[model samples]
Target: MSQPYLAPAELTAEFCGRLLDALDAPLALDHVCVDFQAVKSLDSSAVALLLEWHRRAQAAQRQLELMHLPSALSQLIKVYGVEEFLQIKA
Candidate 1:
């Protein structure tokens, strides 16, 4: 939930450059929800960010749910064979 949605004119480049802005008490939160609907495009950077969050949450014994993931983003994740790792909850 800390990641911001900065929709730049360049759809391909549009992204939330800062991925940990609101993670002050990440360990205290029961869950971390990331809304990816506004992400028109996704790339390796997105995957990396997701993985990082997943790892952190797992290490802290917390949960991370990715909501409204775009079809393209989902496809990318599947293509990368990281669906299991994402553990995308409804």
Candidate 2:
């Protein structure tokens, strides 16, 4: 089981790309838990990160879960109608 814990500092496109690119590693695993407690800002790229993870997870027959989501992140996901897809219940 492999997982990447995201930090607010990692909410950039480059970092997100690197992280998403690694989703194929430890291929046996099928879940990603993103820690958003430190995230002070919500960006489209970050949403794409989670969405991409969820997309990859689904495509790869897996799942994506967010941990300790800030209000902003939660609201953003809800706004984008991805709460259901990403299982954003935190």
Candidate 3:
């Protein structure tokens, strides 16, 4: 598996393109994890990005795990009703 992806501090719509671009790179691993420890801010767009990444991972026949998710973000994910889909790590 590849090293966990470190998320940017500011997870907003402005960074979506760059984040998506990074994901566009070919990943040979069967499982991937995104570390959210560095992320201090998040918005609906961030949630959308995560969902998109999960979709891409599924399409690629890989598993996506979100690690070290902040409480705020976790709450947001629950609010958005996607905790099961995102498979957030404890």
Clashes of each: 0, 0, 0
Superior by TM-score: candidate 2 or candidate 3 = 3
Candidate 2 has an lDDT of: 0.67
**Model 1, 8-83: lDDT tens per residue?**
2222424435654433265465666656656655676666666777788788787777777777767777778898
Evaluated against the true structure, the overall lDDT of model 3 is 0.79
Superposition error at 33 for model 2 (Å):
2.1
Runs off by more than 4 Å, candidate 1? 1-17, 20-24
* Top TM-score model: 3
Best by lDDT, which number?
3
Put the candidates in lDDT order, highest first: 3, 2, 1
User: Which stretch of 10 consecutive residues in model 3 shows the poorest summed lDDT?
Assistant: 21-30
TM-score of each model, in listed order = 0.68, 0.70, 0.86
Residue 33 lDDT, candidate 2, scale 0-100: 61
- The stretch of ten residues in a row with the least summed lDDT in candidate 2 is 22-31
Cα RMSD of predicted structure 1: 4.3
